[model samples]
Target: MINFVKIILIFSLMASPCNSLELYGKFAQGGLITGKVDKKIDLYVDNKKIKISDKGYFVFGIPRDQTNEIVIVTKKNKKEIKKLIKKIQIRKFKIQRIDGLPKRKVSPTAEDMKKIRSEGKLISKAKNINSNLNYFFDSFIRPAKGITTGVYGSQRILNGKPRRPHYGIDIAAPKGTSVLSSNSGRVILSERNLFFTGGTVIIDHGHGLISIYSHLEKTFVKKNQLVKKGEIIATVGSTGRSTGPHLDFRLYCNNVPVDPDLVISLN
Candidate 1:
């Protein structure tokens, strides 16, 4: 009778529905996580389906300001396996306030309204271009040599009114300084004389990663051009509501703006 009971227990253990599921990564904000499971699993962050890939391997990234506990669930054979990710530390960032920006710089006059509308249309068109960007995991290089004038996440106080936080890092450089591609990507937008950004160029770095270079003295790359890392794409300039010659570099993941400094090593 004891032997019979042991045999039954071993069979039940072997027939259990738990798969080889593992969720491993740094549990910090703005960090990337790698997940593996035996079967294709539906991934969710705060109850939003982000993505699912074949072979049960998927990647998810935490935003810089996210603080909620992440929950991952996989269901097989009507049984659910749940995993809770905790103790995530959201990094604290510095906030800067600028008090001297002129009113005209923040608000355009009636004469410039038409240009603003035109620029908006161009930005809308560029945002619609879809690029299967997931191959941009290479190291990033500085696009130009200059002093770091502005930083990411700084709150803007335009004429005593709080504005949206600045999402890009600004480098102060001389006019006509050559701007290079930070990583390999396909140019998605190249437009000159925008209302606010001036000569702007946007590159899609596969898998929803994009880089925007603004206030260019001249644009060298065209739309749909594939550029390599460190290749010259534009020249820095002071155009379109800028105080002086500088480059405003912005990075985005899908539609969410992210800090460029978080992914790249400036040193």
Candidate 2:
């Protein structure tokens, strides 16, 4: 095993981990950072004001292609302190040519484009809700286990034509394989049918942290419902623009996509 994350801190507050401003977790491409500081201390990562839980915990995420270095600042008791975390860990994405996709999926006409735009708005609105609940501290679990087919940040070529880079991890499973919730959170959106993702479910696990599950045969939960970690929420299937039975899972922080592989352990 290799350590993909490299951490650099400007100063250490104390010998204890919980006393001063401390950042825990990996600092890499698609990495997540959870911080612990003194209560009532305001913290900002890259100038964005992030929420600090009641227990003095806050989390932030690094995007898959964040070229700029991360900057963290702390403001408390009329004093402002900042530190340069580190540069991003750039990844080499290979071109993945996926054939046998429907022509309409590859090249949608005006009518299909209309539907795509509408669904995109709905999805965006669902992910925009910044809830105050913090449930991500419990860790995440695999939604559906099988063979991994696609990875994050990979340039996808559908039918030999280049398309958007893949933003989620694709897992191949049986049509009826049960899909579990990656963490405990409230179901914000459970659209049964979408233009590209078929049945899509978006869970908000507090603050701006969210996970998306797409291409489902059926959704078991509804919007605004509370779900526990590892709860069965849907089943895998080849819906909407898919070539085979699989699930596309994605994780996001502050609405920006992050790599799910770095956030959780596969084994």
Candidate 3:
């Protein structure tokens, strides 16, 4: 009966349910992963339904502190077709201490709290826009020329007080240095000054993928404007709660913050 068992194994392998599933990109925390499946199937990550493009392309993000294995499920109609388990690579973050930030900026006043809340709503609304543009499939470019001063997933201790982790890359450059668009996208939010991230601009790269430029000296693009890859969208500067002239660039997929440096390195 050994031959009979071998024949059954071959038939099972041939009929595997997830043969059409394909994935790409880093499978670690703060990483962006692109996936593909049969156009007729639905993809879900951790039970959240992911948006699949017309061409079967989809994307997801791993949060910085996601340490557990992610469960990816595919379904056709109401039937569960297959499941894939993705183990996340844990990251060790550095503790970054900023000594000289203004006390008010670090710990805002009651009036400042209102401004922070209002500005935060705008930023959140912009980043959560889901579009079908599909420009995220293109390779990304560096948004500025500068020395890398900070990195993603680093703990921030601002003015002697511990704060949240830094979710963006800080590129040190001279004030007024042009900041380019990392990918072709539509500008969703362009604010001249916010409470924290002054002169911020957010671009939607389609499929829940977005790019954010903060601490800008100037903004060249407006809300709803279409920008091309490497196009000048802003200039570097020390604004808001910044310590020096630098560009704080960030990327996100499905509203989950990701590493901008990792996204560019994917090219």
Candidate 4:
């Protein structure tokens, strides 16, 4: 009778749904996480369907100021699995005061607002381009070799006025200093004379991963161009809303802006 009961329990367990998901990488704020699941179906992060690689791999990131838990749901043929990721560490950032910004930059005129809006549309459009490339899995290199001027998540106070938290890394270099691509990607945005970021370039590194190079002195690539890792894509510049010539590098995955210093090796 005991053997019969054990056999019935084993069969019941085998009939139940199972999940064999493995997630690796940082799970804290401003961290990127890559994971693989048992089967390829549909995956949603925070209720939004994000891009998944061709090999059942998906990537996502926690924003700089996010404090809530992340929920990932995978569904296949009416069967669903919900993963509740709750161990996100909070980050404390410092406030930075800038007193030397040009008055025009700090306080943009009405015409500047129009141009800013137009350029912002272009940037947003580029970020929405999802491709099948998996180049983000490749280790990234520093976009420019320079002294680290600023970091991500730092609160920005321009001319004593509070602004958005800094979402990228700032590396100071002389004008015309070559800027390199950290990973292989297709150039999605190559704009010059933008109101704020000056000559900005954004590359799509496949699967909703994007890299941005802002305030460039010169852009060596054009829109929709393919670039390899460590290739020269731009030059350091102080154009747009900058005090000196510097490269503002940013990394994003699935619409979440993450800290490049944490993901990519700078040293």
Candidate 5:
């Protein structure tokens, strides 16, 4: 008989010849799910191969608006085996409206568009990193101390024009406020200035999981640098399409944006 495991918060699936597989974390929209399996077993989420570390740990993210049940399949000896179906809870998002001054930031000219496109490539490259480090298993801390002004999955209306849903949490703080690393990871990309994010820093926490810090006033870390959790990596600032000083904190699992709040709860 095949076993299918349904998860709510925490559970352990026993599929023998392999011992026990433990899973935990939020299982809702914009949630990040992580688990551990035996080294000999192969696992997948939604048919996409999950990169398991040598110690048998793996991670994946739930889409912000995903309503369909997640499918988890495991195979061994090049043959089909057990499966686990995870159902994610739905969430209601908030609407945010902002009235700003500069028309160019909202609607850029052809010249600015060229720069935006190029900077986008850099950001995308950093977000897609899949390293083998297992730093993601560490406890996470808030990137900075501030009041949350914007939340994940929120609809943003800028100057009465609708834009893409906000994927990061906007924390409002005074300029030069210190921003710390949420967890131990290697810096993958550190750009002083980008078209939208201004000064940005992206850290890879291993196994396709990464965290992004944007709108920085100054960066203390450089590319390929290893940072410890709660270490000061940068200072907050209002740069690149901003009205005031703030930090836009974000996290991505396999390039899919997940809620930073949900991830921090893993601590």
Candidate 6:
């Protein structure tokens, strides 16, 4: 009887829930995860350091092209705890091809490249600003009404040459069409012209989430302005290297670009 009791006690001790972590998310593509963790524990995903919030919570996002198993390790006081490895889900996306001519057009020259590089520096600065607010989850609306010409994660063969996969969804609308805010966010950038993007706008939705609107005819909102969902922020145009009047909408979570279609439903 004494030996049986000791064996039961040992089994119970081994089954304790402490030193364990639970992770889950709606979508696993692009190496993204949202979960909770111990405050004092050091966390590693596939041996990479991840950022953790002060409340002992953490969210790590991976890019679309990365495909590998994730390993999470937590440590404290030289003691280590590891969770069972989780395999990342591979996403299969569709391809789209667009052939069109533009009414108004401009080509990038050597001088234009210099100007674009300078403007890129400003856009990069705005996207890195961190705010302690949760304004992104408030309702999302379409920025403009038009036909979706291009989709996210689509491989592009532009003018008979292959290019990088399209990261933004293209909305083909008439020139001067009003572009509204998809959700409440602070305007991080409003540039009039870029070499590839033409006029561009970026909004920070807090918690490392950001939205970018590119190829605009006109910009109505200024930098650092707080905008509400459905607010008119810009006008559609065929600026930059585009072939027609349209809006290119892109979304990112913690520097990892995500499919906007996953976050919001389109009408």
In the range 153-242, model 1's lDDT, one tens digit per residue, is: 677776677778787899999998999998898998998878788899998876566789999999999999999989999999987767
Writing each residue's lDDT as its tens digit, candidate 5 over 50-163 gives: 888999888899989999999887776756566778787788999999898378989999999999999888888887888899988676789999999999999999999999
User: lDDT scores for all predictions?
Assistant: 0.69, 0.82, 0.85, 0.79, 0.86, 0.70
Evaluate residue 261 in candidate 2 and report its C-alpha lDDT on the 0 to 100 scale. 76
TM-score of 3: 0.92
True-structure RMSD, every candidate: 10.2, 2.5, 7.3, 8.9, 4.3, 9.4
Looking at model 3, how many pairs of residues clash? 0
lDDT of 3 by residue, 1-267 (tens): 011110101111116554477776777788888766777888789999999898878888999999999998878886887777877777788899988888989999999999999998998887788899888877788899999999999999999899999999999999999999999999999988988999999999999899999999999999999999999999998999998999999998878999876677766
> How well does candidate 6 match the true structure in TM-score terms?
0.75
- What total of clashing residue pairs does each candidate reach? 4, 0, 0, 0, 0, 2
lDDT of 1 at 71: 67
Which parts of model 5 have CA positions greater than 4 angstroms off? 1-17
For model 3, give the 10-residue run with minimal summed lDDT. Answer: 1-10
Structural similarity to truth (TM-score) of each candidate:
0.75, 0.91, 0.92, 0.87, 0.93, 0.75
Local error of candidate 3 at residue 259 (angstroms) = 1.0
The sequence of per-residue lDDT tens digits that candidate 6 reaches over residues 1-267 is 011110101111123454345453433454335555555667787787655566555556666776776676666665665544666567776766544523222334677668877987886776666565455434356689999888778887665555688887899999999998888899988988877788999998776777899999999999889998789999999888788899999877666776665545422
Candidate 2 or 1, higher TM-score: 2
RMSD in angstroms between candidate 3 and the native structure over all alpha carbons: 7.3
Q: What RMSD value applies to candidate 4? A: 8.9
The true-versus-predicted C-alpha distance at residue 68 of model 2, in Å, is 2.5
